[model samples]
Target: MQTTQFMITPASGKRLIAKALINYAPVQSALESGTLVIIAGTTNGYLAEEILSSIGQLEDFSREKFFRGIVLPPSQPRTENGRLFDESGFPGDVVIVDGKWKKGLTIFDVADDLVEGDIIFKGANALDVHKKKAAIYIGHPQGGTILASLRAVIGRRVRLIIPVGLEKRVSTDLDEIAMKLNSPGAHGPRLMPVVGEVFTEIEAIFCLTGAKAEMVAAGGVAGAEGSVWLAVSGVKQEVAVAQKLIKSLSREPLFSLPENE
Candidate 1:
């Protein structure tokens, strides 16, 4: 097995992540013409939003677009603070609200509207919905469940785009990583095994490690103490290429350490 390693302090993780994303051909292609990119994750939404906002390609569709032809959820009334909350069956580009968790939408809702040039950045559920139509699904290895479900639905169409920070990498094998991360008491829920099962079914896998988020308050990296991100895909050729890229990126540094002082 091959692996890639990146070593960065928390302060530089986010910037490295953004740079790594630019390396993906799918993302670069999608950015050519602003497309609707859906970002999903447990708590990484804020980071994803910030990244997209800095990219200068995000589109905030209003009710008019939803009513016209853009297939999105209805816009809810803005709050006193000008914030919009998610209501039942409400879909929009930007998810800026509070207390707005609903049953969630499926890929079928937006599959018909997805074009070959569109991009998607989502978690497991959203990936399951748009895997067939998505050029690439960007996130961690936990997204395997979505890939497995997508394979059942579309028989392998989407590719994987993984962006990771150096602090998240580990020397353990995939199974061990899954076990440690998904164990009942691990990270608040059982996610590792589920993600592990999905890894076996995907075609391509890309892993990037070298982004650290500086924790201004904690005086260190937010989750950089010991964390990593894994991403898998259902596209074989793409996965093979990604594996090679990961290896190339993981090569040992050529610098030498100084003598003991």
Candidate 2:
């Protein structure tokens, strides 16, 4: 795989949007036999949904894959106040709360218990548990929490796949990302200082160049115009997959770095 660094301005990058980015081939390739996938983002769960839609696993894909299964947080159940409990029935051992996994837990803790040989969509902690065992996908957030969590769990050799809309760019570095996560105005009611603490710990970073909305459309679903998406995995494959998806959407080039010379 080719690993190179390129700079993209928020204005130019946002133009592409999540609706225009997403390379399914790389993502599809990653899902061979037993690959755990963890998705992270700030939205309620729209980001995760958009990603699944893109990969042909979504029902609207017309041809669904029986081999794929999704395990979401208990809080996001199908019933009323679903976001307050775990409806997915994730084995208690896999779920992590504060630094502890459930009874049957192993690598991941209670909050980090999302795993699958196929793909698993989850929040930041869950992504941490499966970082090495799976791919990671991230979307728009205040900053730091997901990155920091990656650092705590993923360590130095870990890679990050960040698929973000141009709308979510900051001109600052990881430190800046932390500031936003801590700033009262940055994130809404879900105020938690730990979010900022985790973000600052991220040492490895890679940006996935694509739009979430477009990836959702590729899943053959309609009415996905303004939805969010998430995917958590190593940086190399995720960015590569995103580049491929960007190419499929239009004849125009995916991205062009400004002349530095």
TM-score of each: 0.37, 0.31
Cα misplacement distance, residue 247 of candidate 2 (Å): 12
- Score each candidate by Cα lDDT: 0.34, 0.30
Give the top-scoring candidate (TM-score): 1
lDDT of 2 at 45: 24
Off by over 4 Å in 2: 1-26, 36-56, 60-153, 156-158, 173-261
How many steric overlaps are in each model, in order? 16, 41
What is the lDDT, from 0 to 100, of the residue 115 in candidate 1? 51
The stretch of ten residues in a row with the least summed lDDT in candidate 2 is 195-204
User: CA lDDT of 54 in candidate 2?
Assistant: 56
- Residue-level lDDT of model 2, residues 121-199, one tens digit each, is 2332221211222222222254323443344334432223343332222234433444555567654322121221111
Clashes of 2: 41
